[model samples]
Target: MNTTPAFSRRSWLQRTASGFGALALHDLVQAAQTPLAVKAPRFPAKAKRVIFLFMSGGPSQPDLFDPKDYIKRMHGKTISAPINTNELRVGTDKFLALATHGEVKPRGQSGMMISDLLPHTATIADEISLLRAVHSDNNQHQPAALQFHTGVTADVRPSMGSWISYGLGAENSNLPNFITIHPDSDTRLYGASFLPAAHQGTKVVIPQGDKQSPIDYLADVSGDAKAQRARIDFTQRMNRRLLKGAEVDARMEGMIESMEIAFRMQSATPELVDISNESEATKKLYGIGEKTTDKNGRACLLARRLSEAGVRFVQVTMGGWDHHGNIRDALPKSCSETDQPCAALIKDLKSRGLLDDTLVVWSGEFGRTPWSQDLSGTSPIHKHGREHQPESFCTWMAGGGIKPGFTFGETDDFGFRPVSGKVHLHDLHATILHQLGLDHEKLTWRHLGRDFRLTDVYGNVVKEILA
Candidate 1:
């Protein structure tokens, strides 16, 4: 029995009440609390929120960030190098070719050695810092990503974005403080679980197409504006009545805030998502035109727009990095999609002087392993394949309070594990929160009779990377 029916544009718009023109998108999803309302930082705050770029499908570290001297130590190892060198699958072979292509050289004044695949990012090396020793607990997909986004890698905690929204009220009264834009075939990437429904990212502008106007209802579902007010009032009354005896319902408060902001967005979102208002030059710089019109570029452009409009957090999620095989062939396309716009976004932010206050993070759930999955190959490099590695990887930081042009931490010669300045996922989260003026350890909710925080009991601010 096929109960699912075909979806049309009109039906889609009506079903997804969120407007198309990028209206008060954050309000679309209700949150349990506001992160902006968290206590002021003990010291100076560097950033307000975060723009997290999640590269799902785990990118390989050796091929991308850390080409090591240790690969030679294990020469003759054979594995499937998924891409350019795909035919090189073998067993019991040593040393996979350190990197598929060119070397990762020191760039900018900081001399951070980013792989050649990320040439655009190299230009701004002096403005960014790289964390080379990020190790996670898992090798699987959903679990790792979930743990990365939510503090409980075990699948039982609130997400960092959700916690931030909970701690702080929205900075923009008319918009949701936290927003996420992920272009994928699935919805779970941005779905809200225990967090208040309102706190979840409002998919203001889905990645359908230009005419889709992701925010269709944004203009007004009704001909009469005042009539809209009546609907909001009616909904609020129902919520208030439903929880009449509740001691403290953060979820309900989040709902109230969302509704209020939605009413206000009727006047704001259309303008914010309108690239027409931006200079043609700016669009060109973002690679919105011609040959560079890739999905990742569009996301980067949207991220810049959202941040400029005062969005507290604008997460641009680009999945499909899982290069278990064919890495050499896939990396070029993957790099093509991201390399340019990411760098452009930074340059644009700096030009607008927003970089100092806006923080950008590029990372994945975990890195791919140095050894091939089968552990038996003939050549130093596999046939463009790499296995899962929870031991070590890299992530980058720019703007906010991060020290630019620096590479923090180190991995063993084979890039198998972190040997210096190891920072775990929780520590990273804590540091991000610290920059936004909240103590990750202190910003907690009493759930199940215990105080649960974004960092839990572990996590220390990596002060060395601070500006």
Candidate 2:
């Protein structure tokens, strides 16, 4: 003490500032370590979790779920149907030739008409509620995909998964609330725009084989656990010292939370992805060993495990459905890759008693036109492919509060537009929120001096489809 210099005004001020910084750092560290605690919904929610099976490119509805008897009769004949002006226009032509493939048969006890292309899905038709007249405002891939996932065609918004995560919080303290497998490069499908950063989806590349980890970054690069712990502790402390506010900064909070989750994920994700422990019989049921269904089979099986482990929302994407040309060759291959695995996931969920509280959704962005895109007006050329049609499409739901083996809404005779029971994209979002015990009208976040909701102030829950 005698050797120490006397404190001056400048020294005193510097010491006090350092101390304040340390206090702020402490606050940040605490925020980082905070775990996701399960929260109650606005009301009693029927679904504990949701698994969205998103088919990236639009699957043709005229050739699949919505069967029009007149398409075959009017094949290669010019027909005019009321087309939605908002949808993408193929060309200047007013009328186009009609065409359809695949046999539509009544499936399951519900007598819902499904195309023969999805034989496995047909088996579980009774467990599904098919919305045959789903429509949207966009027909292009990027915009339509945006609308389907975020309830907006152009602007960045919190995705449906992010909305669910924000509403109910996370079920598992160690796992992320939202996870996307093989997510599109387009971040809008899963981004948490305007929402808390922690609500964003965690993306994992699809596992190519049993040997690889589901997430490549889950493993620690350094072999020293003690060093890792020390580093984490130091980093957290430093981060805390930089934070200052009545509340911890949101960005700092998310960064800290992500670090904690990543550390825990190092231990949890590997075991979840390793399917070698699964029985041969179960693997066969999911068509895991088969060449055609292996990729999607693994994804679906992982979805089941993640849901059982209490992940709030898991989205699995299957791409390559843009069949504008040679649709006859492309559609069946897409169906072959998904059908068995999709059906198996439903059956597995039901067997585990998870189906009652797990909501499963399958849908594409929009649908294909019933009329062919005749490029040349002179000859009947360019008749092999169909244009984008946002007027009508199909989406199916199973489990949770959905009415089983039911079909709602109807398209016109040519499957061009919804004539009855039309369900808009906003309504779909509202209904999904309703099942998760959220009031779409009230589940909103205030940003830029406005209260914005997932439904964007436009949606009525489809009560008729509820069980």
Candidate 3:
């Protein structure tokens, strides 16, 4: 057996042409060969790209997005009674404090109240419409996460991304329609159930350590231009030979096309991933080249770069939003890492006039419980800890026809349930598609002898959330 210091996944796949990254390489190797169909939107499309700020764990609506301190003080005597006389209610022995120390100030002419942790996002308040009352069915993480993306709380379904990619064929046939990046080098968020194999996200790069560039794998050496082309051409002959007998197999076709695209993307993506070309001020605005916001900021900047490059949808995730314990320690770090990049992405899109045609969503699956799990009202402060609260949550949208700086819906005095203008995960999904020029109910695929859609069977577009 060959005694080379074995292919330890990264070194093998990332370095040599035939390396450990075979599975990942295979996705690209097959991209061009697949014959996929596309369906146009029902109306004129306003946005060409979508960027999602996925807070892996949830953020507390009461403590972060929805302010209920006034209600808590007004009903100081009746704090134990039901805070909300609505369809949903939460048990309470509550002591609420905004996770960040700064004031919950209003921004833009729209008077949107944003938490201080997101200083960068605050400046772009006029560019966003804050959805303050998003509710989910699952309290647990896995199902809730799947629910947030697929719109089905329990049953299996295609994720919104797969559906989007299926409906809207990629803008740049050379690059993937859906791309995801992480700050922590984790990769557990993407899957495609029954949709076309091409609908799944192709992770061009994965997080390994210390905010490494997200485009490294996509970069190819410039030294051997002719040699590389000759090698790729020769390999294609072999791949084509294999495809000769497999005319009925779509996977072979996809693999053949993907290989060509991969070779092309190796040259294109590095430019998109590099932020150094951006102005120093722009980098600082994005928290790039900064001593502090290295992790979260990096992903945010890359999202903008990818969007502008004609990618259909880009998701940048900064986890650790669970706030289960040591939130005071954990939340701040994650928020700080993310805030500037979040704001910078919005600002960059707006300044370039792309914001009006692009959709930006910032959200967590669920939220933290309103009452402190560790601290009591009597205590001034305590160690970080928060239990799951799916009753209420926060998510915001900017551009792509969404209202700006306007807060929609409400929660109770203790900030637990939606009293008015309640928005469910399904409703939010419906609204997102509506803005993108697709009727959620109409966008469907046949599977298991039934019509399948991103919103499942229940969702009405929250018209009030529209710009």
Most lDDT-accurate candidate = 2
Instruction: Tell me the deviation in Å of residue 333 in model 1.
Output: 0.8
Question: Global lDDT for candidate 2?
Answer: 0.80
Model 3 spans > 4 angstroms off: 1-39, 70-102, 154-156, 183-188, 204-253, 375-381
Name the 10 consecutive residues with the lowest summed lDDT in model 1: 19-28
Q: Which stretches of candidate 1 lie over 4 Å from their true place?
A: 1-42, 72-98, 183-195, 204-208, 215-219, 291-293, 373-382
Best by TM-score: 2
Collision count for each candidate, in order: 71, 2, 19
TM-score of each: 0.83, 0.89, 0.80
Residue lDDT tens for model 1, 67-97: 7765644543443433334434342143244
TM-score order, best first, reads 2, 1, 3
- Of 1 and 3, the candidate ranking higher by TM-score: 1
Question: For each candidate, what is the lDDT?
Answer: 0.69, 0.80, 0.68
Error at 347, model 2, angstroms: 0.7
Error of 2 at 155 (Å): 2.1
Give candidate 2 regions above 4 Å deviation. Answer: 1-35, 84-88, 91-94, 209-212, 246-248, 374-383
Q: Mind giving the per-residue lDDT tens digits that candidate 3 earns over 96-138?
A: 3324333566777877887777677778887788887789998
